[model samples]
Each structure stands twice: as C-alpha cells, then as structure tokens.
Target chain A: MSSTINLFMAAHHKECDELFAQAEQAVSEGDWEDGLFRWQAFADELEKHFTREEQILFPEFEQATGMTGGPTQMMRMEHEQMRSLVNEINKVGTARDMDQFLGLSESLMVTMQQHNMKEEQILYPMTDQSLTNAQEIIERMNQ
Target chain B: MNLHKLSLDTIPPILTPFRFFLSALLFGVLAALLLLYSREDFWFTRWSNSNLALTHLLTIGFMLMVMMGALYQFIPVMNGQLIPGSKKLAPVIHVLMILGVLALVSGFLFSNSELFQAALAALGTASGLFALSLLPLLISRLGNQLIVYLLRVLFLVLLITLGLGLFLLLGHALPELNLPYRFYTDLHVLWGLAGWVVLIIMAVSSQVTPMFYVISEFSPRYLKILSLLIILTLVVMSFYTVFISKQSGTDSAQPFIYYTLAFLLSAELLVFVFYTLLKIAQRKRKIADVTINFYRLSMFSLLAALMLWWVAVFLPLAHLTYLLAILLIYGLAISIINGMLHKIVSFLIFLHLQKLSLKRPEAMTLVPNMKQVISTRNSQIQFMLHLLSGSLLLISVHYPALTVLAAVFMLANFCWLSWCLFQAYLLYLESRKKILACPEISMSL
Candidate 1:
C-alpha cells in the first residue's frame, strides 16, 4: 500500500519537473506563446495533485487519526504561496519583462522542489504506513 | 491516519503586527501623494528635496511596511515553525519603522535644517534597530536560501542607500561636506529599486507562485543561484558605472550598461512567468476561483508591460518611456499587489474562521467564501480605474489636466481597496467573537 502511494507521488513529481524544464527551454528561447502554454500546463498539474491530496487523502487521514489541522493547514499555506508566485509570474509575463520573469522563476523553482521533497519523503511515507486501508485508497484515487 | 492537530492558540500572533503594518502603508501612500503634489512646481528637478521625501515615503513607508507585514504572516507558515520573536518583536519593529519613516521623510523635506539632520540620524538608527530585530529569525531560518539571500542583500542595500541619502542631506546642510551628490543619489535609487524591492519580491514570489496553485515545485538550486547572480551583477555594474561615469566624464557608456542590465533582468522575469504558467497549466484542480483569475490577469499584464518596457528602452520617445514606467510600476506592480491582497485577506479570514469553528462550529455560519471577503465587483472596478489612471497619467506628461484626473481616479481606487480590506477585517473579528462564545468540542476518536 505504501509502495503504491510512493510510486504515484514520485511519478507526479517527475512529470512536474519535466514540465518545468520544458517551460524553462521555451523561456530561454524567447518563445512567449509556447512558454505560456507549457507553464499553464505545469500549473494545472499541480492544482490537480493538490486537490487530490486535500480532498481525498487529507480527509481520509483526518477520519482515521482524528487529527485535522497541522499537515493540511501547512499544505494549504504552501498552496497559497505557490499561487501568489504564479500570479506574480503572470503579471511579469504580461509585461514581458524577461529578467524579472527568469529571476522569479529561479527562486520559485527552488522553494517548490524542497516542498515536494518533504511531502514525498516524509509526509507521504508516514501516511502510507498509518493508513492500513492504503490499497483501497490508492485504487479509489486511481479510479 | 489521524493527523495531530496543532492548536490555534499555539500559532504565533501575526495578525496584530500585520494590522500595524497595514496602517503604516495607508499613511505612506497618503504621504507620497502629498509629497508629489508639493513637487509639482519643479517636476523634472531630479534629486530635489521634495523628490527625496516622495521616494522615502514610497520605499521605506509603503514598500517596506507591506513587506514587513507579509514576512510576519508568512515566515512561520513557510518554515512550519513559528518565530520566537514574532509575538514580542513585531510591535517594537512596527513602532520603530513608523517613527523612522516619519523622521526620514521630514529630514529629506527639510534637507538643510539642523533639526532635520538630527531627525535623519534618528531614523537611520531606528531602521538599524529594526533590521537587528529581524536578524535572529533570519539566521534561524537560513535553510530557506532564497529568502535568506534576499534578506541579506536587502539589508546591505538598505545601509548603502540610506548612508548615501544621509550624505546628500548633510551636503545640503553643509556645502563643505564635499560629497559627490549626483553619483551617490543615482546609486541610491538604483540599489533601492533593484536590490531591495526587486530582490525581496523575487524571493517571496518564488515561494508563493507554486504554493498558491498547488503546482509542482520549482528547482531550488537554479532559483537561489540565479537570484544571487543577478544581484551580484547589478551591484557590480551599478558601482562600476557610477565610478566610471564620474571619472570618464561621458554619458555614452551609461545607456549601454543600463540597457544590458535591463535585458538580463527581463530575461529572468520571463523565465519566472513561463515557469509559473506551466505549473498552473498542469494543475488538476478544475475550479476557477477568484484568486486564479486575478493570477492569470496579472501574468498576462506582466508580459504586456515587459514588451512595452523593451520598446520604450529602444525607442527615442521620452513620453513612451514614461508611459512604460507607469505601466510597469503602477499597472503590473499594483495589479499583482491587489490580487495577492485579495487572496491573502481572504485566506487569513478563512483560517481565523476555521479556528473559531473548532471551538464553535455553529458560529461558522457567517464565514464568507474567498470571494465574499473581497468584493469581486469592487476589485474589477478598481482594476479598470487603475488602468485608466495609468494611461491618463502617461498622457498627462503633455496635458497637465489629465494628471489631476489620473490622481483623482487613483486615489478613489485605493480608497475602495482600503474599504474592502476593512470589511474583511470586520468580518474576521465577528467570526472570532462567535467562536469565543461557543463551547469547545472534544475530539472524537
């Protein structure tokens, strides 16, 4: 059960990284149109991933453990931070200020990767261990 | 799978400090406008005493106030650990900052007066103290490299800029001070804008962009290195140019270096935009919230503003350059701030409401959605007003009446935003009261 959750999260992380790289390439080449498209795609993936965690995984965890606030709240806050950056990037993108855009992207990338690492290595593994009905949860999530 | 619930009471008191900062920002904006109006007589007079007043109001008063408030609220959330001094030191810093800004602005306005010189020294001391207060939290959280680096750089730049400004003030008071006023003045502005404001914004945004959208994470190493490199390059180039231009007695090389720096900065900004858009695009969430819409609009505007800047830099039209600056500063910067303000206010309110709900779920009835906390209608109207004012102000360079109209609209829009923020605050308090009245519920395990 734990392995499945780990695998799913790992795959998602990899996909996200790949998308980020593509966006970087587009930016470096000054392909605003394609860059915008790819970047939006990356943001979408993240939204979906977070939604699954918040709605499906988090609720189940809360029900099982009766602890509701800490992890979920932290995750939500991180989500807020990411959204703010996206908004900033969007603003900079509209201005077409390449230097500001690149600088912001570089900083954002680092913060996000670290956030993912904590979730992947610590939180997700802990969840997998605590939830005995993990297989069922994974199947439901997949479905 | 029960997660351990962290008590709301245990969370550090960030809201009180933020309120003080917000109040400071309000005053700062008003001060800036008043200073600008006073300088109407000699609008193009660079390095004038009145201009100094306006600059300080904008930078120290408005920008720093907001930045400090945000850091107070966000740092703990980011690190998953609360700052020890947050509850105690925030108020102290806030008082110092406000008094410092007042003193500094007064000093700049009365550059030649002995009393004003003393005031300036006091303001500098207050700011130094405020910076010192933040050192502990900053040092403890050195793990967040982007923020840490930005804070360090901002501190250094603040010292340089403020020191240069003081020198200029002394030079005004005592002509024998023998200061190279113009050189230091230019360097001061450059450092304040690029080093302090831009760097901090970059650092905060990196964490925020992904967090807001629940997007995949960014590459941390790349971000930290890029930010450091940009700052280093800008600092080196600014100093080199300042000294070289003075020595060589030529303005020819100035434009080249400025343009090169601008191009590099633009490239960096573009990368950020692209990366954020990519993350948002990949998000699985189907719901289109107000925050998301504002975020999208801001991103689009950033790109448009950048293009305009590029054109303005290359083109020979003075009016165009002025217009582009307005668009970039007021249009892009304000829009992003407005959007983020909406979300931040709403989220904070929501969190407070949820905390109350824990004690009394019934009291949660009045808790508003993110949209209700900030009226979308008001925001839309304000955004349009901002756009119109920006356009008019640009044209105002030729037609004086348009400038007055621009100022009027801008002020009105800002009032509307302030009202919305106040409304959110009231709602938050009401919700808190309801929670306090209700009986706490025991956890069901």
Candidate 2:
C-alpha cells in the first residue's frame, strides 16, 4: 500500500543518509579505505537518486501539473548544487585532506539532507497526489 | 494552486532572521551590563526591580527576539508556506520588538509608568502584527505534520502569554486598575517559560537533533502525544491557579495538585533531555563539533534545573528558584540557541552564497564552506566563554559578591558571540564582493 513514490523516494533518502553517515564515521575513525568506499557508495546512490527524480519523476510531475517551471526547477537547481559539492568532496577525498574532506562532508550532508527533505516532504507527496501512475514511476525508478 | 508557496525556493531574504539575531546579541550584552551595574543585590528577590529588568532583558529581549526570528525562517522551510508579506512586515516587526523590549526593560528598571505604557503599545502592536502575519499560514492547508501542529499550539500559547503580560503591564502602568497581580504574574511566567519557550525548544530539537547529527529520528507519534500531554497539564494547572490555589494557602491539599503538575512537567522534560543526550552521545559521525559541545552543556543544564526544581518543591529555599531560572534560561535555553546560532548562521550564509554561485559559475569558487563562514576555533572559544559565564552567574546566585566577576564573563561571552557573528558577516560580504567582481557566467541547472 505504501509503494507510492513518497515511500519509495523517502526510503532511498534514508538509505543515502545511512551510507553518507557511515562514510563520515569511517573517515573520522581514520579508516581511509572504508571511508572512501562508503563515500563513493553514497555518492553513486545519491546521483542515481537525482537521476531518478530529474529523469523520470520531475518530468512526469511537470507534465501532469503543467507547471514545468516550479518546484521541479528548484529541485533541479538544488541537485546541481549538491552535485557540485559532491565533486568538491571527491577532490578532497582524493587529496586525503582529512580536514577539508570532513568540512566539505558536513556541508554536503546538510545540503543533501535539506534537499532530501524537500523532495520527501513536499515533492514526493505532491507527486503521489497528482499522478495516477505513481506505482509505474516508482517501478521505473527501481529499474 | 499557488504551488510556488509550497516550493522550497522561498527563502526569506537572509536579513530577515539575521537582524533579529544580531539584535539578540545586543540584548545579551545589555543584560550582562545590567548585571554588572546591579551587582549582587539583584539576587535577593525575584520581585526586585533590577532583577525583573534583567529577566525581561534576557527573556523578551534576547530569547524571544531570537526565537521569533528563527520562526520566520523555519516555518516557511518546514511547512513550505510563506508568511504573507514577510519582506516588508518582518523588518517592521523586528523594529517594533526592539522598541518594545527596550521600553519594557527600562520601565522595569526605572519604575516609569510612561515607559510601561509605551512598552504596552509597542509590544502589543508588534505581537498582534506578528500573529496576523502568521495567521494565514497557520490556518491554511498545512500538512498534519508534528512541527506544524506544535507550532500551531505554540503560537496559541504565545498569544495567551502575551495577553497575560499585557494585563500585568497595565497594572504597572495604571496602579488604580485592580488586577490579581500575583496570580496573573505566576500564570504568565508559567505559560511563557514552560508553555511557549519549552514547547518550541522541544519541537525544534526533535527536528534538529536527528537531522544535524545523523541520529535516529524521534518517534513523531510519541512526540506529538508528549506535546499534547504537556499542553493538557498546563491547562489543568492554569485552572488550578484560577480556582483552587488562589483561594487556599500553602497548607491546603490543593497545593498537592501544584506539586503534582510540577512533578509531571519535570518528569516529561527529564525524558526529553536524557533522550537528547543519548542521541548526541550516540551520534554516528563523531567529530569535533562546537555545536555538540553546546548541546551537551545545555542538556546537562536542563537536567540540573529539573533536579533543582524537585528540590525547590520539597524545600522552600530563597535562592533555589533563582538558581532554577539561571539554569533554565541562561544555561539551557541560551546555550541551545547559542549553539544553533553558530550552525544556523553559517548554514544560512553558505546557502545564500550557494545561490550566488548558481547565478555565476565564476563565483562558485568564492563561496565559503560552512565551517569557513564561522571557524571552529572561534566558535569553540565562544562556547567556552559562554560556559564559563553561565557557570559564574549560577555561582553568583549564592555568593552575590561574585556578581561583578560573573558579569565580566557574561559581557565577554556575549561580546565574543557578537564578534563571531560579525566575523562571519564580514567573510560573507568579502566572498560576495569577490564573486560579484568576477565575470558573470551563465550556469545551467
């Protein structure tokens, strides 16, 4: 019953959160290998999340609501912001600049969480309310 | 459908909250100076003029100012609904609050009826205007989220607190107006402190703790039930104050009801504080965070205050209530806000700068990271100062002779906080200038 976009997307958010937190924890404990592993995992999952929303969900939301330049656009902009932050984080991680990496991680964590909050709280619910094919969209997201 | 209102893009111009925050720092400084000027004698009684002035300065001037500002920013973000006409009205409300708090503080200090009258007018108008601005959002089609529900109740209690305050002020401004002064005063303090302030803190903490620290989320159902119970207890206590306690002396069995309510409140808060502490201690990403330090301090202070509250109920001591106030207000409430201020101010600056970077890719390099906006070193130093000052003030309750020393630390604490904020603001301005000077380049999202 809760297989709607809201539940699907929100579960993905929590997964990303856990992965990101594990990476940060590993880094804090000086486990560079595990840290980078977890960090890459988190980044990959996050990028996939963005792709799912930007590719499948947002377009459906825009077309269904006929509001192409609305919340979806803002979400798109925030996604780009997070992407940029993530790229910086990758650089810091590669350099093994622990302090800088941690700092950027904090920044990314906040940016990513707030972004996820908007998507989960506002966008996903709106998508569920407005779309008739939410299950299908979620299925596509899974694929 | 005005879906734009629900869009997360609607950040109030950053100055909306910053003005109130910087103003709060000024009040904190003023409170410190007032403590220095009044010396240890202000500790003798809660009813003393200077003590009342100091209390108002902290509660209304510092705490309420910051809380109101935070609300203006957070309500929109959380509920995804904009306050109507926030751009213009927010500044006006900020100015009115400044005037109102100053007038009220001066009225208390100088025993000036005219200042009390001025305070009444300014504060009443400001509260009314603020409540009006929020009315649309509160009544609108907000989701049945715990935060929205809590804010709705918090706002109602705030209005009641203000109404009681206004009546009390009227009694001061016009001595001939027969008012149940003691009764109303107790009720006002209870509603203001326990109802409005504590409730808002609980609501904000539930949201903030898990999100910021990457801890497990609080059970929303449990929190909602707890909030409702707190409100219900307050309602019952108010009725007791009105009917039962007013007619009887301390020896009456009705006083047991008072004790019971206090015990309930203390137990509830104990649960909140312990849970929060455990969450913080168990945070997965254990890093050297100044905010965590502040949170720990505030939680411990809350625990101490709760313990002392129980002791006060058992043994009627002169200094216990005063100690409880210090622990609650300065130690707990101010500590949390101070911690939040560091994180929030940095986050806000970083957010706005991020938007600028979006407009121009050349500016992307210019945006400072969150920690760079307020360096960890500076924030940690400020936290230490705050802890030292709060501890000294608590000690000054027993040894009034230490008031000057305590005031000195308090002054230093607030001044340091102001300087930290000013430093961040300067960094922001510097970054903005460098970014703006760079060639504008189109960036696609």
Candidate 3:
C-alpha cells in the first residue's frame, strides 16, 4: 500500500521525462511543426501532473498532516516557476527561435527535474506514510 | 522526517556558495602563477617544495574549495535538511579555507614554520566547524540513503586526511618531532585523493548524471557494493604500507602486493569511467550540451590516467607518476567540476530569481533566464581554454621547458573561468536589484 503512491507517481514522472526528451529532440532537429506538437504534448502532460498533485494529493497530505505551509507550498511555488517557463517556451516555439527555445527548454528541464526529485525522493514517500488511503488518493490523482 | 527540512528556502544565501566558487577560480589563477614562477624547478621531483606547493594549491585551494561549496548547496537539498546554521557557518568556513590554503601553500614554498602553524590552525578549525555542522544532516535517514552514507564517509576520510596533513605540518614546523614524512605524506595523499576526492566525485556523478542528462539511475546496490570494495582495498593497502611492508622490507613480494592493490584501485576507477561514459552515450536527451562534452573529456582523461598509472608501475619512470597525478587532478577531477560550475551557477541564479519573482509578481518580467545569466558562448570559450591548458600541462611533464607556456595558458584558463562566473554574478545582482525595485513603488503607495 505504501509503495503504491511511490510507484504510481514515480512512473508518471518518468513518463513526463520521456515526453520532455522527445520534445527537446524534435526542436533540436529543426522540425518546428513536430516540435511544437511534442512540446505541447509535454506541456499538457506536465500541467496535468502538477494539477493532480496540487488539487488531489497535496490537499489530502496537508489535511492528513495538519500543516499548510511546508513542502507542499514549496512545490506549489516551483509549479508556478515551471508554469512561467512553460509559457515562455510557448512564445519561443511560436517564434521558432532555436537558440531561445533551447535555452528556455534547458532551464525548464533542470527546474522540472529537480522539482520531481524532491517530490519522488522526499514528498511522495512522506505522502505514502502520512496518508492511510494511499490507493484512493493515487486514484484521485490519476483522474 | 522533519517537515521543515523539506523547505527549498533553506538554501544558503546566494553569496554563500558564490563566494566560494569565485575564490576557487582565483586560487586556480594563483596555482598557474606558481607554475610560471617556479618554472622547470616545479617539475624537479614529486617531493620538491615547489611541486608540493603546486599540488596543494590545486587540490586544497581549488578542488576542495569548490567541493565544499557544492556540498553546502547540495547536501541540504539532497538530505532534505539544511545543515544547522549554514548561512553563518559558510562564510566563516570560506574565509578560513582561503586563508588556510594560502598559508599552507606559502609554508611549502618558503619552508616557513610559522606559516605551517597558521595553516594548521585555520584549516583545522574550519574543517572542524564544517564537520560539526554537517554531522546531523549526514546521519539523517532522509532522502537518498546511499548518497548520504557516501557523504558521511567522505567527511570521515577528510578528517583523517586533515589529521595526517597536520602531522606532516608538525614535522615541518618542529623538526624535532621527527615524523616519518614520506610514510605519513603517502597516507595523506592516498586518503585525500583516492578516499575523499575520488569517492565524492563518483557519488556526485551518480546523482547528477541521471538528473541532468536524462539517463537511467545507476544501480544503487551495485554502486554500494563497488564503493565497499574500493574502501576495503584502500584500507588493506594502507595497512600493508604501514605495517606489513615495513616488517618484510626486503621482500620483493611485498612490492608486488602493493602494485596489485594499486592496479585493483585503478581498475575500479576504470570501471567507473566506462560506466559513466556508457550512461552519457545512452542519455535520451541528444542535445549538444557543453557540460556533456566536459563529462566525455573528463572520462577520457580518467581512462588515460588509469592506463598511465599501470604503465608507471611497470616502467618505474619518475615523471610518468607525475603525469598520472596531473591527469587525475587537472584533467579528470577539475574538468568535471568546471562543467558543473556552469550548470550549477546558472541554475542557482535562475532559481533565486524565480523565487524573488514569485514574491514580487510584477518583477517576473525582469528575471534573466538561465541562459541569459550565463551565455553558452562564454562557457564554450572557457571549455576551449581549459582543454588547451590541460593539454599543455600534460605535455609539460615530458618537456619541462614548456612549463611556462603551460602556466600562461593555465592562467588564462582560470582567469576566463573567473570572468564567466563574475559575469553571471553581475547579472544576478542586476536582476535582483530590478526585482527588488518592483516592490518598492507598491510599498511607497
């Protein structure tokens, strides 16, 4: 039961990582149309992941732990940071500026990877332990 | 799990790590200057004062300085707990380390007893305070346990290395102490190089390679086993050198066992280099990142060093050993660090600025993105300088007269590194000021 959340969320993180690589590769290869398609797919998947955590998992964890301003808040802030970068990358995508797109994507990659690390390595495990209905919470997040 | 420990805000003030990074580059410049000043005499022997001074300057002055700074930033985040009072401890430790390295290098260059004593005091206190601050975090069972465990051993080895260093310094400061300089210094170098430096680099690679390069994680169980074997071999070799080899001083078999141990250690490092290269090649992100190139070059250097170590053992050439050390130190370790500095500094600036923008939403537009903070053009130039100087330094081992030319390039290499970092810092400060000013008008109203 405890391992379920870790397994589920960590898999989602890997899926997002794969999407990110595909998007980055397409852009690097100068396929603007395909690159934009892949990038949008990545951005959408990432937003959905962030939403799942923030809307379902985070509030549950917060309620379970009775702490509002903690790791979740930091994660929320990082989500906003990534969101801004995602928006910037969209602008770069439209302009088809390879260097600008690469630069913005690189920053997003680092920011997103580090955020996922913290969540997978620390927060998710804590979520597993702190919440008794781990399966149900993960189910909610899946939707 | 202390919930408060997970707060990313616990990252030390920007200056804490940045000061150390900039100072490390300056010391790198100092090292190159020492090379130019000493000229060919620096290559006279591994035991020469000039040689020792140069090694310390690069090792303690540059490599260790940067490592400590990275640790301050990395450990807190990785362990999910900040080192206690890190903001205060970091600056004091940075100053002491700087003073200590300079004093230690001076003691070697001039054979000054007072300088040696000063170095001992400064370094001893600095490492002591740092170790004390980091102990709780290292002991915690949070985050990645293997990395935490490896970090714990790194600190322990560092203490042993420091202890050996101080004993050697005592022999220099007070000749009457009559310490066996050769024996103790061998142990010191072994602990410092193989034990502390190599292990930390490998540990860092395990974490960074997967995260930054989009590769699969190295098998932790396998890594743990490999780490244990390396430590076991080091312990056995040290024990042989200290006790068994001395008892059977005339036995040719003793030297054979020593060489065998050395080969085994080199083999382990070879395995690490190959494994890392394979991972780098396997990275899903096929971007032409400068840092990935740095990793490849460093791995190549490591492979070269390992082969040279084997050759040095069989041939018993005086200079080949020196070349091996140079490859390991400058070519391998320093190259990886140089690459990391670019990524870490840029990301740090972006992170802090992002945090600031989060606080002051109006300032969001003012933040410089990561690439804007440190342009790829600047880093690519730094890479070329680093490669040229490193190649020249390798060649200087064979042709001693080229030492000055190598030194000049080395000086340029470090100065360029300094300029790159300084430019990024300037960008950070400029962006930070603009961000702060955004809130000013609102508050005034």
Model 3 per-residue lDDT tens digits across residues B325-395: 88888988899899999999999999888877776878877877778888899889878988999999989
lDDT of 3 by residue, A30-103 (tens): 99899899999999999999899889999999999987888888888789889988998899899999988988
**Candidate 2 iRMSD in angstroms:** 1.8
What would the per-residue lDDT of candidate 1 be over residues B1-445, giving only the tens digit for each residue?
A: 2224222123455375456546644764575366337534424554566656655665567666776676666655544444455677667667766776676667666654664566556566656666676676566533345556666666676676677766766665565777667667666665665455555555656667555554555677766776676677667767666777667776565778767777887777676667656766775432233555555555665676567778767675555534544554455455566667766766667555654564455554445545556665666765676566656655666665565566666666566667778888887787677677877767431
Model 3 C-alpha RMSD to native: 2.2
Candidates by DockQ, descending order: 2, 3, 1
Tell me the docking grade of candidate 3.
medium
Q: Quote each prediction's TM-score.
A: 0.70, 0.96, 0.96
Candidate 3: the clashing residue pairs are none
What DockQ do the predictions score, one after another? 0.05, 0.57, 0.55
Task: List candidate 2 stretches off by more than 4 Å.
Answer: B1-5, B249-253, B316-318, B443-445
Which 10 successive residues of model 2 chain B have the least lDDT summed? Answer: B246-255
B-chain TM-scores per prediction: 0.82, 0.96, 0.95
In the order shown, the candidates' Cα RMSDs to the true structure are 10.5, 1.8, 2.2
Fraction of native A-B contacts kept, per candidate: 0.00, 0.40, 0.53
Error of 3 at A42 (Å): 0.4
Candidate 3: lDDT of B386?
A: 88
Per-residue error (Å), model 3, residue B187: 2.2
